[model samples]
Target: MSAVGLTYLTLILIAYGVSSCSSKEKTQRSLKIAGLSLWRLLPLLAAVFGLVGLFQVFLPPELIEKTLGESSGVASLLLGGGMGAVAIGPPAAAFPLAGTLLSAGAWPPAIAAFIVSWVSVGVVTLPFEAGVFGMRYALVRNGIAFGAALLIGLLMGLVL
Candidate 1:
Protein backbone atom coordinates (compact mmCIF):
# COMPACT_ATOMS: atom_id res chain seq x y z
CA MET A 1 0.00 0.00 0.00
CA SER A 2 1.00 3.59 -0.53
CA ALA A 3 2.16 5.76 2.36
CA VAL A 4 -1.03 7.78 2.00
CA GLY A 5 -3.19 4.68 2.29
CA LEU A 6 -1.24 3.48 5.32
CA THR A 7 -1.59 6.88 6.99
CA TYR A 8 -5.34 6.92 6.39
CA LEU A 9 -5.62 3.40 7.83
CA THR A 10 -3.64 4.44 10.91
CA LEU A 11 -5.88 7.44 11.40
CA ILE A 12 -9.00 5.30 11.12
CA LEU A 13 -7.65 2.92 13.75
CA ILE A 14 -6.88 5.78 16.08
CA ALA A 15 -10.29 7.31 15.52
CA TYR A 16 -11.99 4.04 16.32
CA GLY A 17 -9.99 3.61 19.48
CA VAL A 18 -10.68 7.14 20.61
CA SER A 19 -14.39 6.86 19.85
CA SER A 20 -14.62 3.69 21.87
CA CYS A 21 -13.01 5.37 24.89
CA SER A 22 -14.88 8.70 24.60
CA SER A 23 -18.26 9.85 25.89
CA LYS A 24 -21.25 9.17 23.65
CA GLU A 25 -21.55 12.79 22.58
CA LYS A 26 -17.92 13.02 21.47
CA THR A 27 -18.13 9.75 19.57
CA GLN A 28 -21.25 10.94 17.78
CA ARG A 29 -19.57 14.22 16.86
CA SER A 30 -16.54 12.49 15.47
CA LEU A 31 -18.69 10.17 13.38
CA LYS A 32 -20.68 13.09 12.01
CA ILE A 33 -17.52 14.96 11.04
CA ALA A 34 -16.04 11.92 9.33
CA GLY A 35 -19.26 11.27 7.44
CA LEU A 36 -19.52 14.84 6.28
CA SER A 37 -15.90 14.85 5.06
CA LEU A 38 -16.42 11.68 3.07
CA TRP A 39 -19.61 13.07 1.57
CA ARG A 40 -17.83 16.19 0.44
CA LEU A 41 -14.97 14.29 -1.20
CA LEU A 42 -17.06 11.64 -2.96
CA PRO A 43 -17.96 13.60 -6.08
CA LEU A 44 -14.38 14.67 -6.78
CA LEU A 45 -13.14 11.12 -6.32
CA ALA A 46 -15.84 9.72 -8.57
CA ALA A 47 -15.07 12.24 -11.31
CA VAL A 48 -11.37 11.41 -11.29
CA PHE A 49 -11.95 7.66 -11.34
CA GLY A 50 -14.53 7.94 -14.09
CA LEU A 51 -12.18 10.04 -16.20
CA VAL A 52 -9.38 7.51 -15.69
CA GLY A 53 -11.54 4.67 -16.96
CA LEU A 54 -12.77 6.69 -19.91
CA PHE A 55 -9.21 7.60 -20.94
CA GLN A 56 -8.14 3.99 -20.70
CA VAL A 57 -10.99 2.97 -22.98
CA PHE A 58 -10.65 5.73 -25.55
CA LEU A 59 -6.93 6.47 -26.03
CA PRO A 60 -4.76 3.40 -26.00
CA PRO A 61 -1.00 3.45 -25.37
CA GLU A 62 -0.06 2.56 -28.93
CA LEU A 63 -1.70 5.72 -30.26
CA ILE A 64 0.15 7.92 -27.76
CA GLU A 65 3.47 6.33 -28.68
CA LYS A 66 2.87 6.67 -32.39
CA THR A 67 1.97 10.38 -32.40
CA LEU A 68 3.94 12.06 -29.62
CA GLY A 69 6.88 9.67 -29.76
CA GLU A 70 7.95 10.86 -33.19
CA SER A 71 11.29 12.70 -33.40
CA SER A 72 10.54 15.92 -35.24
CA GLY A 73 11.97 18.51 -32.82
CA VAL A 74 9.56 21.48 -32.57
CA ALA A 75 6.79 19.63 -34.35
CA SER A 76 7.03 16.83 -31.81
CA LEU A 77 6.85 19.35 -28.95
CA LEU A 78 3.75 20.96 -30.43
CA LEU A 79 2.24 17.54 -31.01
CA GLY A 80 2.88 16.60 -27.42
CA GLY A 81 1.32 19.85 -26.20
CA GLY A 82 -1.68 19.41 -28.48
CA MET A 83 -2.20 15.86 -27.30
CA GLY A 84 -2.13 17.10 -23.74
CA ALA A 85 -4.70 19.77 -24.55
CA VAL A 86 -7.02 17.26 -26.17
CA ALA A 87 -6.95 14.77 -23.30
CA ILE A 88 -8.81 16.43 -20.45
CA GLY A 89 -8.86 14.66 -17.08
CA PRO A 90 -7.58 14.64 -13.53
CA PRO A 91 -3.99 14.07 -12.38
CA ALA A 92 -4.90 10.73 -10.84
CA ALA A 93 -6.38 9.70 -14.19
CA ALA A 94 -3.34 10.89 -16.15
CA PHE A 95 -0.82 8.86 -14.14
CA PRO A 96 -2.08 5.51 -15.37
CA LEU A 97 -2.28 6.85 -18.91
CA ALA A 98 1.31 8.02 -18.62
CA GLY A 99 2.36 4.55 -17.47
CA THR A 100 0.61 3.02 -20.46
CA LEU A 101 2.29 5.46 -22.85
CA LEU A 102 5.71 4.80 -21.36
CA SER A 103 5.20 1.05 -21.66
CA ALA A 104 4.32 1.60 -25.30
CA GLY A 105 7.65 3.41 -25.89
CA ALA A 106 6.68 7.11 -25.52
CA TRP A 107 9.55 9.36 -24.53
CA PRO A 108 9.61 10.31 -20.86
CA PRO A 109 9.66 14.04 -21.56
CA ALA A 110 6.65 13.89 -23.86
CA ILE A 111 4.67 11.79 -21.41
CA ALA A 112 5.54 14.15 -18.58
CA ALA A 113 4.37 17.13 -20.60
CA PHE A 114 1.21 15.40 -21.69
CA ILE A 115 0.26 14.38 -18.16
CA VAL A 116 1.06 17.75 -16.61
CA SER A 117 -0.78 19.71 -19.25
CA TRP A 118 -3.72 17.33 -19.24
CA VAL A 119 -4.44 18.13 -15.59
CA SER A 120 -3.07 21.63 -15.17
CA VAL A 121 -4.71 22.93 -18.32
CA GLY A 122 -8.28 21.88 -19.09
CA VAL A 123 -9.93 22.89 -22.33
CA VAL A 124 -12.93 20.66 -21.66
CA THR A 125 -13.70 22.23 -18.28
CA LEU A 126 -13.25 25.79 -19.51
CA PRO A 127 -16.93 26.74 -19.35
CA PHE A 128 -17.31 25.49 -15.79
CA GLU A 129 -14.05 27.06 -14.73
CA ALA A 130 -14.99 30.35 -16.29
CA GLY A 131 -18.39 30.30 -14.65
CA VAL A 132 -16.91 29.75 -11.21
CA PHE A 133 -13.58 31.58 -11.38
CA GLY A 134 -14.24 34.16 -14.13
CA MET A 135 -13.07 33.97 -17.72
CA ARG A 136 -9.94 36.10 -17.21
CA TYR A 137 -8.68 33.99 -14.33
CA ALA A 138 -9.37 30.73 -16.12
CA LEU A 139 -7.76 31.86 -19.33
CA VAL A 140 -4.61 33.24 -17.68
CA ARG A 141 -4.15 30.25 -15.40
CA ASN A 142 -4.51 27.79 -18.28
CA GLY A 143 -2.18 29.78 -20.49
CA ILE A 144 0.53 29.82 -17.84
CA ALA A 145 0.03 26.13 -17.12
CA PHE A 146 0.32 25.26 -20.81
CA GLY A 147 3.54 27.23 -21.19
CA ALA A 148 4.97 25.78 -18.01
CA ALA A 149 4.20 22.26 -19.14
CA LEU A 150 6.02 22.84 -22.41
CA LEU A 151 9.04 24.36 -20.66
CA ILE A 152 9.11 21.53 -18.16
CA GLY A 153 8.99 18.99 -20.97
CA LEU A 154 11.88 20.65 -22.78
CA LEU A 155 13.93 20.78 -19.58
CA MET A 156 13.22 17.13 -18.88
CA GLY A 157 14.33 16.25 -22.39
CA LEU A 158 17.55 18.12 -21.86
CA VAL A 159 18.29 16.84 -18.36
CA LEU A 160 17.09 13.26 -18.68
Candidate 2:
Protein backbone atom coordinates (compact mmCIF):
# COMPACT_ATOMS: atom_id res chain seq x y z
CA MET A 1 0.00 0.00 0.00
CA SER A 2 0.98 3.64 -0.36
CA ALA A 3 2.60 5.45 2.54
CA VAL A 4 -0.51 7.59 2.95
CA GLY A 5 -2.73 4.53 3.11
CA LEU A 6 -0.45 2.87 5.62
CA THR A 7 -0.39 5.97 7.74
CA TYR A 8 -4.17 6.21 7.71
CA LEU A 9 -4.48 2.56 8.63
CA THR A 10 -2.08 2.97 11.47
CA LEU A 11 -4.01 5.92 12.80
CA ILE A 12 -7.27 4.03 12.62
CA LEU A 13 -5.78 1.05 14.39
CA ILE A 14 -4.43 3.26 17.12
CA ALA A 15 -7.76 4.97 17.54
CA TYR A 16 -9.61 1.68 17.72
CA GLY A 17 -7.17 0.30 20.22
CA VAL A 18 -7.50 3.35 22.44
CA SER A 19 -11.26 3.25 22.30
CA SER A 20 -11.37 -0.47 22.99
CA CYS A 21 -9.05 -0.02 25.94
CA SER A 22 -11.37 2.60 27.38
CA SER A 23 -14.53 0.53 26.82
CA LYS A 24 -16.08 -1.82 24.27
CA GLU A 25 -19.02 0.55 23.92
CA LYS A 26 -16.81 3.33 22.51
CA THR A 27 -15.32 0.96 19.94
CA GLN A 28 -18.75 -0.22 18.86
CA ARG A 29 -20.01 3.34 18.62
CA SER A 30 -17.03 4.39 16.53
CA LEU A 31 -17.43 1.48 14.12
CA LYS A 32 -21.14 2.10 13.83
CA ILE A 33 -20.57 5.78 13.02
CA ALA A 34 -17.95 4.94 10.43
CA GLY A 35 -20.09 2.31 8.77
CA LEU A 36 -23.14 4.52 8.68
CA SER A 37 -21.21 7.43 7.21
CA LEU A 38 -19.65 5.26 4.53
CA TRP A 39 -23.04 3.81 3.63
CA ARG A 40 -24.54 7.29 3.39
CA LEU A 41 -21.80 8.54 1.09
CA LEU A 42 -21.60 5.44 -1.12
CA PRO A 43 -24.35 6.46 -3.50
CA LEU A 44 -22.96 9.98 -3.94
CA LEU A 45 -19.50 8.62 -4.63
CA ALA A 46 -20.84 6.19 -7.21
CA ALA A 47 -22.73 8.95 -8.98
CA VAL A 48 -19.63 11.14 -9.08
CA PHE A 49 -17.58 8.35 -10.64
CA GLY A 50 -20.35 7.72 -13.17
CA LEU A 51 -20.28 11.41 -14.11
CA VAL A 52 -16.50 11.30 -14.44
CA GLY A 53 -16.68 8.31 -16.78
CA LEU A 54 -19.18 10.15 -18.94
CA PHE A 55 -17.06 13.30 -19.08
CA GLN A 56 -13.93 11.42 -20.23
CA VAL A 57 -15.64 10.60 -23.55
CA PHE A 58 -15.39 14.22 -24.64
CA LEU A 59 -11.56 14.46 -24.74
CA PRO A 60 -9.63 11.98 -26.83
CA PRO A 61 -6.11 11.14 -25.66
CA GLU A 62 -4.59 11.25 -29.14
CA LEU A 63 -6.01 14.67 -29.85
CA ILE A 64 -4.80 15.98 -26.50
CA GLU A 65 -1.25 14.86 -27.24
CA LYS A 66 -1.28 16.11 -30.79
CA THR A 67 -2.52 19.54 -29.84
CA LEU A 68 -0.19 19.87 -26.88
CA GLY A 69 2.77 18.45 -28.75
CA GLU A 70 2.41 20.66 -31.83
CA SER A 71 4.25 23.46 -30.03
CA SER A 72 6.68 23.13 -27.09
CA GLY A 73 6.79 26.85 -26.51
CA VAL A 74 4.72 28.99 -24.07
CA ALA A 75 1.71 28.81 -26.35
CA SER A 76 1.40 25.09 -25.78
CA LEU A 77 1.59 25.53 -22.05
CA LEU A 78 -1.16 28.15 -22.10
CA LEU A 79 -3.26 25.99 -24.35
CA GLY A 80 -2.71 23.05 -22.04
CA GLY A 81 -4.02 25.07 -19.11
CA GLY A 82 -7.00 26.18 -21.18
CA MET A 83 -7.79 22.62 -22.23
CA GLY A 84 -7.42 21.36 -18.67
CA ALA A 85 -9.77 24.05 -17.42
CA VAL A 86 -12.38 22.90 -19.88
CA ALA A 87 -11.80 19.18 -19.39
CA ILE A 88 -13.58 17.71 -16.38
CA GLY A 89 -13.27 14.22 -15.00
CA PRO A 90 -12.03 12.32 -11.99
CA PRO A 91 -8.37 12.20 -10.94
CA ALA A 92 -8.19 8.54 -11.92
CA ALA A 93 -8.89 9.40 -15.59
CA ALA A 94 -6.80 12.58 -15.73
CA PHE A 95 -3.53 11.00 -14.62
CA PRO A 96 -3.53 8.33 -17.31
CA LEU A 97 -4.46 10.82 -19.99
CA ALA A 98 -1.67 13.14 -18.86
CA GLY A 99 0.78 10.22 -18.90
CA THR A 100 -0.29 9.33 -22.44
CA LEU A 101 0.19 12.92 -23.55
CA LEU A 102 3.64 12.97 -21.99
CA SER A 103 4.67 9.74 -23.73
CA ALA A 104 3.33 11.10 -27.02
CA GLY A 105 5.82 14.01 -27.08
CA ALA A 106 3.83 16.59 -25.21
CA TRP A 107 6.04 19.07 -23.32
CA PRO A 108 6.54 18.54 -19.59
CA PRO A 109 5.41 22.06 -18.69
CA ALA A 110 2.32 21.67 -20.81
CA ILE A 111 1.51 18.40 -19.14
CA ALA A 112 2.09 19.93 -15.74
CA ALA A 113 -0.17 22.82 -16.64
CA PHE A 114 -2.85 20.47 -17.86
CA ILE A 115 -2.72 18.27 -14.77
CA VAL A 116 -2.71 21.20 -12.38
CA SER A 117 -5.51 23.06 -14.14
CA TRP A 118 -7.56 19.89 -14.42
CA VAL A 119 -7.38 19.47 -10.65
CA SER A 120 -7.70 23.08 -9.66
CA VAL A 121 -9.67 25.36 -11.98
CA GLY A 122 -12.54 23.37 -13.46
CA VAL A 123 -14.73 25.32 -15.82
CA VAL A 124 -17.13 22.42 -16.24
CA THR A 125 -17.85 22.40 -12.51
CA LEU A 126 -17.95 26.18 -12.18
CA PRO A 127 -21.72 26.39 -12.04
CA PHE A 128 -21.88 23.90 -9.18
CA GLU A 129 -19.09 25.69 -7.34
CA ALA A 130 -20.78 29.07 -7.83
CA GLY A 131 -24.04 27.72 -6.53
CA VAL A 132 -22.41 26.22 -3.47
CA PHE A 133 -19.91 28.93 -2.59
CA GLY A 134 -21.34 32.09 -4.19
CA MET A 135 -20.35 33.29 -7.66
CA ARG A 136 -17.77 35.83 -6.54
CA TYR A 137 -15.81 33.36 -4.42
CA ALA A 138 -15.88 30.67 -7.11
CA LEU A 139 -14.71 33.12 -9.80
CA VAL A 140 -11.86 34.42 -7.65
CA ARG A 141 -10.77 30.93 -6.65
CA ASN A 142 -10.79 29.67 -10.24
CA GLY A 143 -8.91 32.75 -11.46
CA ILE A 144 -6.20 32.15 -8.89
CA ALA A 145 -6.04 28.45 -9.67
CA PHE A 146 -5.63 29.16 -13.42
CA GLY A 147 -2.75 31.59 -12.85
CA ALA A 148 -1.09 29.29 -10.32
CA ALA A 149 -1.25 26.36 -12.73
CA LEU A 150 0.53 28.35 -15.43
CA LEU A 151 3.25 29.49 -13.05
CA ILE A 152 3.69 25.99 -11.67
CA GLY A 153 3.84 24.54 -15.18
CA LEU A 154 6.40 27.12 -16.26
CA LEU A 155 8.59 26.38 -13.26
CA MET A 156 8.34 22.61 -13.69
CA GLY A 157 9.05 22.90 -17.42
CA LEU A 158 12.08 25.15 -16.95
CA VAL A 159 13.53 23.61 -13.80
CA LEU A 160 12.93 19.95 -14.51
Candidate 3:
Protein backbone atom coordinates (compact mmCIF):
# COMPACT_ATOMS: atom_id res chain seq x y z
CA MET A 1 0.00 0.00 0.00
CA SER A 2 1.01 3.60 -0.45
CA ALA A 3 2.49 5.45 2.51
CA VAL A 4 -0.60 7.65 2.89
CA GLY A 5 -2.89 4.63 2.73
CA LEU A 6 -0.83 2.84 5.35
CA THR A 7 -0.87 5.90 7.56
CA TYR A 8 -4.66 6.20 7.33
CA LEU A 9 -5.07 2.51 8.11
CA THR A 10 -2.82 2.79 11.15
CA LEU A 11 -4.75 5.81 12.42
CA ILE A 12 -8.07 4.05 11.94
CA LEU A 13 -6.78 1.00 13.78
CA ILE A 14 -5.60 3.14 16.67
CA ALA A 15 -8.94 4.95 16.91
CA TYR A 16 -10.81 1.63 16.80
CA GLY A 17 -8.62 0.22 19.54
CA VAL A 18 -9.31 3.20 21.75
CA SER A 19 -13.00 3.04 21.09
CA SER A 20 -13.16 -0.69 21.77
CA CYS A 21 -11.31 -0.27 25.05
CA SER A 22 -13.74 2.35 26.23
CA SER A 23 -16.92 0.52 25.21
CA LYS A 24 -16.84 -2.75 23.32
CA GLU A 25 -20.59 -2.73 22.60
CA LYS A 26 -20.60 0.82 21.27
CA THR A 27 -17.50 0.14 19.22
CA GLN A 28 -19.17 -2.94 17.74
CA ARG A 29 -22.25 -0.90 16.89
CA SER A 30 -20.11 1.77 15.32
CA LEU A 31 -18.36 -0.87 13.24
CA LYS A 32 -21.68 -2.28 12.13
CA ILE A 33 -22.90 1.18 11.10
CA ALA A 34 -19.65 1.78 9.23
CA GLY A 35 -20.03 -1.52 7.41
CA LEU A 36 -23.57 -0.66 6.40
CA SER A 37 -22.51 2.75 5.16
CA LEU A 38 -19.74 1.19 3.10
CA TRP A 39 -22.16 -1.34 1.70
CA ARG A 40 -24.50 1.48 0.60
CA LEU A 41 -21.63 3.40 -0.92
CA LEU A 42 -20.37 0.41 -2.92
CA PRO A 43 -22.75 0.94 -5.82
CA LEU A 44 -21.90 4.61 -6.12
CA LEU A 45 -18.20 3.73 -6.03
CA ALA A 46 -18.63 1.09 -8.72
CA ALA A 47 -20.57 3.50 -10.95
CA VAL A 48 -17.93 6.17 -10.49
CA PHE A 49 -15.17 3.74 -11.41
CA GLY A 50 -17.13 2.76 -14.48
CA LEU A 51 -17.52 6.42 -15.38
CA VAL A 52 -13.79 6.92 -14.98
CA GLY A 53 -13.09 3.94 -17.20
CA LEU A 54 -15.41 5.32 -19.84
CA PHE A 55 -13.76 8.72 -19.66
CA GLN A 56 -10.33 7.12 -20.08
CA VAL A 57 -11.49 5.21 -23.12
CA PHE A 58 -13.67 7.80 -24.82
CA LEU A 59 -11.86 11.07 -24.14
CA PRO A 60 -8.75 11.39 -26.21
CA PRO A 61 -5.60 12.87 -24.66
CA GLU A 62 -5.08 15.25 -27.57
CA LEU A 63 -8.58 16.65 -27.16
CA ILE A 64 -8.10 17.14 -23.44
CA GLU A 65 -4.78 18.83 -23.95
CA LYS A 66 -6.05 21.07 -26.68
CA THR A 67 -9.01 22.20 -24.60
CA LEU A 68 -7.61 22.43 -21.08
CA GLY A 69 -3.86 22.23 -21.46
CA GLU A 70 -1.27 24.98 -20.92
CA SER A 71 -1.99 26.64 -24.24
CA SER A 72 -5.59 27.25 -23.16
CA GLY A 73 -4.30 29.78 -20.62
CA VAL A 74 -6.48 31.52 -18.02
CA ALA A 75 -9.62 30.85 -20.04
CA SER A 76 -9.30 27.17 -19.19
CA LEU A 77 -9.71 27.96 -15.51
CA LEU A 78 -13.16 29.47 -16.08
CA LEU A 79 -14.07 26.63 -18.40
CA GLY A 80 -12.99 24.12 -15.83
CA GLY A 81 -15.06 25.76 -13.10
CA GLY A 82 -18.10 25.90 -15.37
CA MET A 83 -17.76 22.23 -16.22
CA GLY A 84 -17.27 21.30 -12.61
CA ALA A 85 -20.25 23.34 -11.43
CA VAL A 86 -22.50 21.35 -13.73
CA ALA A 87 -20.91 17.96 -13.14
CA ILE A 88 -23.05 15.37 -11.30
CA GLY A 89 -21.90 12.89 -8.62
CA PRO A 90 -20.10 13.14 -5.30
CA PRO A 91 -16.75 14.82 -4.76
CA ALA A 92 -15.19 11.47 -3.91
CA ALA A 93 -15.63 10.36 -7.54
CA ALA A 94 -14.26 13.59 -8.96
CA PHE A 95 -10.73 12.94 -7.66
CA PRO A 96 -10.03 10.07 -10.03
CA LEU A 97 -11.48 12.03 -12.92
CA ALA A 98 -9.24 14.97 -12.01
CA GLY A 99 -6.25 12.61 -11.95
CA THR A 100 -7.20 11.34 -15.41
CA LEU A 101 -7.40 14.91 -16.66
CA LEU A 102 -3.96 15.66 -15.25
CA SER A 103 -2.55 12.53 -16.86
CA ALA A 104 -4.08 13.64 -20.16
CA GLY A 105 -2.10 16.90 -20.03
CA ALA A 106 -4.78 19.18 -18.66
CA TRP A 107 -3.39 22.34 -17.05
CA PRO A 108 -2.98 22.11 -13.29
CA PRO A 109 -4.88 25.39 -12.83
CA ALA A 110 -7.86 24.02 -14.72
CA ILE A 111 -7.88 20.78 -12.74
CA ALA A 112 -7.61 22.66 -9.48
CA ALA A 113 -10.57 24.87 -10.41
CA PHE A 114 -12.50 21.81 -11.50
CA ILE A 115 -11.99 20.12 -8.15
CA VAL A 116 -12.80 23.16 -6.06
CA SER A 117 -15.94 23.99 -7.99
CA TRP A 118 -17.07 20.37 -7.99
CA VAL A 119 -16.91 20.30 -4.22
CA SER A 120 -18.17 23.78 -3.41
CA VAL A 121 -20.27 25.40 -6.12
CA GLY A 122 -23.01 22.77 -6.19
CA VAL A 123 -25.04 23.68 -9.25
CA VAL A 124 -26.95 20.42 -9.01
CA THR A 125 -28.05 21.26 -5.51
CA LEU A 126 -28.90 24.87 -6.22
CA PRO A 127 -32.64 24.34 -6.04
CA PHE A 128 -32.45 22.57 -2.72
CA GLU A 129 -30.09 25.17 -1.35
CA ALA A 130 -32.40 27.93 -2.47
CA GLY A 131 -35.36 26.19 -0.88
CA VAL A 132 -33.57 25.71 2.40
CA PHE A 133 -31.63 28.96 2.54
CA GLY A 134 -33.35 31.46 0.24
CA MET A 135 -32.48 32.20 -3.39
CA ARG A 136 -30.26 35.17 -2.63
CA TYR A 137 -28.20 33.20 -0.13
CA ALA A 138 -27.76 30.30 -2.50
CA LEU A 139 -26.71 32.48 -5.41
CA VAL A 140 -24.32 34.50 -3.28
CA ARG A 141 -22.73 31.41 -1.81
CA ASN A 142 -22.32 29.77 -5.19
CA GLY A 143 -20.93 32.94 -6.71
CA ILE A 144 -18.38 33.24 -3.94
CA ALA A 145 -17.43 29.60 -4.27
CA PHE A 146 -16.94 29.94 -8.03
CA GLY A 147 -14.74 32.97 -7.58
CA ALA A 148 -12.73 31.23 -4.87
CA ALA A 149 -12.27 28.22 -7.13
CA LEU A 150 -10.69 30.41 -9.78
CA LEU A 151 -8.45 32.08 -7.23
CA ILE A 152 -7.36 28.68 -5.95
CA GLY A 153 -6.67 27.56 -9.52
CA LEU A 154 -4.49 30.62 -10.10
CA LEU A 155 -2.56 29.88 -6.92
CA MET A 156 -2.18 26.27 -7.94
CA GLY A 157 -0.88 27.31 -11.32
CA LEU A 158 1.75 29.49 -9.73
CA VAL A 159 2.73 26.79 -7.26
CA LEU A 160 2.71 23.85 -9.64
Candidate 4:
Protein backbone atom coordinates (compact mmCIF):
# COMPACT_ATOMS: atom_id res chain seq x y z
CA MET A 1 0.00 0.00 0.00
CA SER A 2 1.05 3.58 -0.51
CA ALA A 3 1.96 5.92 2.33
CA VAL A 4 -1.35 7.78 1.96
CA GLY A 5 -3.27 4.52 2.16
CA LEU A 6 -1.38 3.46 5.25
CA THR A 7 -1.98 6.80 6.89
CA TYR A 8 -5.71 6.59 6.20
CA LEU A 9 -5.76 3.05 7.59
CA THR A 10 -4.04 4.22 10.72
CA LEU A 11 -6.49 7.05 11.17
CA ILE A 12 -9.45 4.75 10.64
CA LEU A 13 -8.08 2.31 13.18
CA ILE A 14 -7.69 5.07 15.75
CA ALA A 15 -11.21 6.32 15.05
CA TYR A 16 -12.64 2.83 15.30
CA GLY A 17 -10.91 2.26 18.61
CA VAL A 18 -12.26 5.48 20.04
CA SER A 19 -15.75 4.89 18.71
CA SER A 20 -15.88 1.35 20.00
CA CYS A 21 -14.79 2.52 23.45
CA SER A 22 -17.62 5.06 23.64
CA SER A 23 -20.36 2.38 24.00
CA LYS A 24 -22.96 4.54 22.25
CA GLU A 25 -25.45 2.87 19.95
CA LYS A 26 -25.94 5.95 17.73
CA THR A 27 -22.22 6.39 17.26
CA GLN A 28 -21.87 2.71 16.46
CA ARG A 29 -24.69 2.96 13.90
CA SER A 30 -23.09 6.00 12.31
CA LEU A 31 -19.76 4.21 12.10
CA LYS A 32 -21.43 1.23 10.47
CA ILE A 33 -23.01 3.47 7.85
CA ALA A 34 -19.70 5.19 7.20
CA GLY A 35 -18.00 1.83 6.85
CA LEU A 36 -20.61 0.74 4.36
CA SER A 37 -20.11 3.90 2.35
CA LEU A 38 -16.37 3.28 2.29
CA TRP A 39 -16.98 -0.30 1.22
CA ARG A 40 -19.16 0.87 -1.66
CA LEU A 41 -16.50 3.33 -2.81
CA LEU A 42 -13.69 0.76 -2.61
CA PRO A 43 -14.69 -1.17 -5.70
CA LEU A 44 -14.65 1.90 -7.90
CA LEU A 45 -11.28 2.93 -6.51
CA ALA A 46 -9.91 -0.56 -7.10
CA ALA A 47 -11.14 -0.54 -10.68
CA VAL A 48 -9.46 2.77 -11.36
CA PHE A 49 -6.19 1.51 -9.90
CA GLY A 50 -6.46 -1.70 -11.88
CA LEU A 51 -7.04 0.24 -15.08
CA VAL A 52 -3.99 2.37 -14.36
CA GLY A 53 -1.87 -0.75 -13.92
CA LEU A 54 -3.23 -2.20 -17.12
CA PHE A 55 -2.38 0.96 -19.07
CA GLN A 56 1.18 0.92 -17.74
CA VAL A 57 1.58 -2.71 -18.73
CA PHE A 58 0.06 -2.45 -22.20
CA LEU A 59 1.24 0.95 -23.43
CA PRO A 60 4.97 0.73 -23.21
CA PRO A 61 7.18 3.81 -23.12
CA GLU A 62 8.86 2.96 -26.40
CA LEU A 63 5.50 3.10 -28.18
CA ILE A 64 4.86 6.58 -26.85
CA GLU A 65 8.34 7.75 -27.89
CA LYS A 66 7.92 6.31 -31.34
CA THR A 67 4.60 8.03 -31.79
CA LEU A 68 5.30 11.44 -30.25
CA GLY A 69 9.01 11.92 -30.03
CA GLU A 70 10.65 15.17 -31.12
CA SER A 71 8.07 15.89 -33.78
CA SER A 72 7.74 19.66 -34.04
CA GLY A 73 4.62 20.39 -36.09
CA VAL A 74 0.87 19.79 -36.35
CA ALA A 75 1.41 16.05 -36.30
CA SER A 76 3.02 16.31 -32.86
CA LEU A 77 0.06 18.29 -31.54
CA LEU A 78 -2.44 15.80 -32.88
CA LEU A 79 -0.38 12.94 -31.49
CA GLY A 80 -0.35 14.62 -28.11
CA GLY A 81 -4.11 15.08 -28.22
CA GLY A 82 -4.65 11.47 -29.17
CA MET A 83 -2.38 10.33 -26.39
CA GLY A 84 -4.34 12.51 -24.00
CA ALA A 85 -7.56 10.94 -25.22
CA VAL A 86 -6.28 7.45 -24.44
CA ALA A 87 -4.87 8.22 -21.02
CA ILE A 88 -7.64 7.98 -18.44
CA GLY A 89 -5.96 7.37 -15.13
CA PRO A 90 -5.18 9.65 -12.22
CA PRO A 91 -2.10 11.74 -11.51
CA ALA A 92 -0.31 8.75 -9.97
CA ALA A 93 -0.51 6.88 -13.25
CA ALA A 94 0.25 9.98 -15.31
CA PHE A 95 3.50 10.79 -13.46
CA PRO A 96 5.04 7.38 -14.16
CA LEU A 97 3.80 7.46 -17.72
CA ALA A 98 5.32 10.90 -18.27
CA GLY A 99 8.62 9.79 -16.79
CA THR A 100 8.67 6.73 -19.01
CA LEU A 101 7.85 8.82 -22.06
CA LEU A 102 10.62 11.25 -21.23
CA SER A 103 13.13 8.43 -20.84
CA ALA A 104 11.96 6.96 -24.13
CA GLY A 105 12.64 10.30 -25.92
CA ALA A 106 9.18 11.88 -26.17
CA TRP A 107 9.42 15.61 -26.63
CA PRO A 108 8.68 17.76 -23.56
CA PRO A 109 5.98 19.70 -25.42
CA ALA A 110 4.07 16.62 -26.46
CA ILE A 111 4.37 15.05 -23.04
CA ALA A 112 3.21 18.19 -21.33
CA ALA A 113 0.20 18.48 -23.60
CA PHE A 114 -0.62 14.83 -23.13
CA ILE A 115 -0.40 15.10 -19.37
CA VAL A 116 -2.44 18.27 -19.16
CA SER A 117 -5.23 17.11 -21.46
CA TRP A 118 -5.18 13.64 -19.96
CA VAL A 119 -6.34 15.15 -16.69
CA SER A 120 -8.22 18.24 -17.76
CA VAL A 121 -10.18 17.03 -20.78
CA GLY A 122 -11.74 13.63 -20.26
CA VAL A 123 -14.13 12.24 -22.82
CA VAL A 124 -14.94 9.36 -20.52
CA THR A 125 -16.14 11.71 -17.81
CA LEU A 126 -17.99 13.96 -20.21
CA PRO A 127 -21.42 12.53 -19.50
CA PHE A 128 -21.10 13.06 -15.79
CA GLU A 129 -19.60 16.51 -16.32
CA ALA A 130 -22.35 17.46 -18.67
CA GLY A 131 -25.00 16.21 -16.30
CA VAL A 132 -23.65 18.27 -13.48
CA PHE A 133 -22.47 21.36 -15.33
CA GLY A 134 -24.60 21.41 -18.49
CA MET A 135 -23.58 20.17 -21.95
CA ARG A 136 -22.55 23.56 -23.20
CA TYR A 137 -20.37 24.20 -20.15
CA ALA A 138 -18.66 20.87 -20.45
CA LEU A 139 -18.11 21.25 -24.17
CA VAL A 140 -16.65 24.70 -23.88
CA ARG A 141 -14.43 23.67 -20.98
CA ASN A 142 -13.07 20.69 -22.86
CA GLY A 143 -12.54 22.72 -26.01
CA ILE A 144 -10.62 25.37 -24.12
CA ALA A 145 -8.61 22.79 -22.26
CA PHE A 146 -7.68 21.02 -25.50
CA GLY A 147 -6.70 24.28 -27.13
CA ALA A 148 -4.67 25.31 -24.10
CA ALA A 149 -2.90 21.97 -24.05
CA LEU A 150 -1.85 22.44 -27.67
CA LEU A 151 -0.71 25.99 -27.08
CA ILE A 152 1.27 24.97 -24.02
CA GLY A 153 2.88 22.11 -25.87
CA LEU A 154 3.89 24.33 -28.76
CA LEU A 155 5.25 27.01 -26.46
CA MET A 156 7.23 24.49 -24.46
CA GLY A 157 8.71 23.06 -27.61
CA LEU A 158 9.80 26.53 -28.68
CA VAL A 159 11.17 27.54 -25.29
CA LEU A 160 12.81 24.25 -24.33
TM-score of every candidate: 0.60, 0.60, 0.90, 0.60
Which window of ten consecutive residues has the lowest lDDT sum in model 1? 70-79
lDDT of 2 by residue, 4-50 (tens): 99999999999899989999997999899989977876776676556
Flag regions of model 4 displaced more than 4 Å.
1-65
Candidate maximizing TM-score: 3
Per residue, candidate 3 scores C-alpha lDDT tens digits across 1-160 of 7999999999999999999999999999999998998888889889878978987999999999989998988778888998899986778888988998899899999999999999899998999999999999999999999999999999998897
TM-score quality measure for candidate 4 = 0.60
Compose the digit string of candidate 1's lDDT tens values, residues 82-105: 678777644656676677666666
Ranking by lDDT: 3, 2, 4, 1
Worst 10 residues of 2 by lDDT: 50-59
Q: Clashing residue pairs, candidate 3?
A: none
Q: Per-model C-alpha lDDT, please?
A: 0.76, 0.81, 0.91, 0.78
CA lDDT, candidate 4, residue 158: 82
TM-score of candidate 3 to 2 decimals: 0.90
Compare candidates 2 and 3 on TM-score and give the better one: 3
Predict model 3's lDDT versus the native. Answer: 0.91
Q: Candidate 4 lDDT, tens digit per residue, 45-151?
A: 67666765675678776666667777545776778776785668665566666666676677888888988999998888888999999999999999899889888
> RMSD per prediction, one decimal?
5.2, 5.5, 1.7, 5.6
